[model samples]
Target: MAYKFALCLTLPHNTTKMKKKTIILLILAAIVGLAQFIRPDNIKKYENGVKTEDLAGVPKEVNEILRNSCFNCHSSSSELAWYDKITPVSFLVASHIQEGTEVLNFKDWMSMSIAKQKAVLYYSINKIRSGEMPLSSYILAHPAAKINKNQMQVLEAYLLSISARGKTDSVKLKALERDHKWVKPALNGIAYMPDYRNWKAISTTDRFDNGTMRIIFANEVAVAAIKAKNINPWPDGSVLAKAAWTQEIALDGSVSTGQFVQVEYMIKDSKKYAKTEGWGWARWKGDDLRPYGKTINFTTECISCHRPVRENDNVFTIPLNLK
Candidate 1:
């Protein structure tokens, strides 16, 4: 009788435990079923139908590597894998795709502006060189996507070639801008950039304490006038380009001037700039290449700096030949 009573007690406990597990399983089933209904597959964004063929003449080798490794997330040609069809998996895949394309989408390559395209290409090359791309997470499941040494070399060479082409195109664009008088939106400044590289070098200044280096170039007419020291009232169109750079300790332990810092252009415009002085000032910083300061304040700092030398046409550099 006691044994029977013990069995009766144990039976209810076991039954209760079983019932609890069943309830938990039912709740999990309901949660999973509900989650499936909230699928993100249909929600489309930035679905520009840009295609691989759009990059028409891209080399087969580079195209192969890009399609196999990059297209999964970085292109519109994303062919979702089996797991990518699932709820959260789909969400993650979509998010990665969105992010990858924003950075460098091969499909949209041709449509991007030349500058933007070159920037993306350079960025991509740097990332590849650093071995930061073909993310480990991606390569884990897709061994074929891993880039080999030879493949990297091929990509680097191809990208450099493309970058060289971009440089040529940029020069042509600048020439067009110079001749056609391109008027950029005023950032309190003017955008009258000339081919200052072709101008004659007048002088160079280096200040090591401040890590600053400057090169002054002058137009042909200005140089000739300075040689004769007859440039008292400087004629119009006599522009001076001062390119600045930053001094840095290079990898070889040598101190050298690094990337461009700024370019200050002093353009002689007697009638246009007679208000403050006889010079129209404009500046471009770093890789921006856009002129800065369109207002009179541009002259406030400039004029004040040149005030002490007002006796010399309100200019600073008298040139060696002028002496």
Candidate 2:
């Protein structure tokens, strides 16, 4: 009799436990369903509000490749797939579009300077040659966008003129490196960034720094400009206007020491931007590389987050002149 009574009591407890689990599962299901409804696939293009000119003096083959393969993300007109409308995936697609548009927008290609126009073409050719563009993830989805070695070479050859012009900037880069003095400024002062669209943080490149000061490139653009014919305006904010420099270090066996000039800039246009749009710098000491020292009392909304064209070196305008 005692055993049967114990069984009855235990049965109710098990029943209650199962009921709670069912309720929890149902709630989770409902939450997921609601999330799908809330964040449906809705992608939109955000233009820098500039216009583009006609394709002039560009190879027809190169133009077709860009429009069919790259334009979806790199241009204003994104070819949204049906999968883009699904949950979770929708957010991913939207983010890609946002980031891609932020870096390079084909819709607004005419606003850039002639020097920049040439730079864009060369950058694209390099990106293709290095196989760093059309992103592997993108190519996985769209196999047709993939190019052969011959196609890549063809595009590169077609861009030889633009690349030739980009070579002129190498002198400036070399001059800046040699002439620029190393000034270690405190990181708590005002920082200035000219345009929000063309800014990024100082990155620590292990490849360039020999594991020391960590080579940093700043004031970089995010994407290569188009060189296709009739593609003008090329975007203005793609060019960064601010102070950019690298740091040097002295080291011991176990510890690293010394300081190099970080970065400093004053707001050139105070009326157009807010105090948040000020000057800032970063210091790299050993492994603890963060924005430190004296800084101007300004916010870092505009420049600190601009997408980089290179790995992390914000300044992508500087073409690697192999020509």
Candidate 3:
């Protein structure tokens, strides 16, 4: 009887081990299957019709570092990675590249006005300092992209130098100012209108950073309680207006100047208008609103992501853009 009991216990142990093995194998299979769906895409290599020239004065070390670590996403000629060919991973990689390049494309660096370029570089420094660059998850996969303390210092120094140069380039400054004219309007708290500018509706998004606010304006008729009726008959051509602003809190608990500002228009099948679907953000100086930059950070979609802020009418901490 004792021998029989031992046999029974041993058999169960073997079965348990086999079951654990099966689970692990299944998980691995899922990961592989998901990878197959993420085919690598070389879509970001499009030319922007901008002229490229030698960086005669740029520090070789800084240029090289950026080329290897940042250009992959921040430049138009990003080198495709081996894993980027797979499915889900490819999607994520493509998203990151799109976002990165939109925010600051090195290949299009010459295309920006000097002032805009300086502003972007400053923002880049802040982004890196805040541990937001090379994105932590990205570094995990490509260890070579990791920036050590020394490398970070080099990058910061390079940005400072570039900013100084950018300020002196008046021609570039004028060009950039025109592109980012929305900053002037937002600073004075003016209502954005399509009539004044060739503005059109764009996508929306809901995920906003702290002390930021966004608003979406659309034809009230288009909204038409369609959700209640379980109908979405609104023409996809109907435009949605969107704007976003980032704010900072003063030491006295009052809101300071706008940290960022943006405006765009979009079209969507759904009647809802918010920043979460897709939008853009401006890079405004925290201390002073006059100094500003531009970004395509999907400000339109900011509202949809912040479901928790629906109590505030889907707005975050930013005050209303218009009275």
Clashes of each: 3, 37, 45
- Write candidate 2's Cα lDDT for 1-323 as tens digits: 99999999999999999999999999988886687776633364322322333344467887776766677677666666666655667777677777777787766555433444456777776787688887898788678778777777767776664445565655654343332122223354323232332444333332244433432223333223322211122233233323323433435544332343333332223234333332222332321123443344323432555334324233323323211
165, model 3: CA deviation in Å? 9.7
* Superposed Cα deviation of residue 133, candidate 1 (Å): 4.2
* Greater-TM-score candidate between 1 and 3: 1
**Which regions of candidate 3 fall more than 4 Å away from where they truly are?**
12-20, 23-31, 38-57, 80-85, 159-323
Tell me which of candidates 2 and 3 scores higher on TM-score: 3
Question: Which ten residues in a row are the worst by lDDT in model 1?
Answer: 177-186
- Lowest lDDT 10-mer window, candidate 3? 278-287
- Model-by-model lDDT, in order? 0.71, 0.50, 0.55
Q: Tell me the lDDT of candidate 1.
A: 0.71
Candidate 1 is scored at a TM of 0.47
Please provide, for model 3 over 51-145, each residue's C-alpha lDDT reduced to its tens digit, 9 standing for 90 to 100: 33333335888777777778777876656577764566777777788888787778765545455556766776688788888799899878888
Off by over 4 Å in 2: 1-36, 40-42, 46-56, 161-323
Question: Residue 322: error of model 2 in Å?
Answer: 51
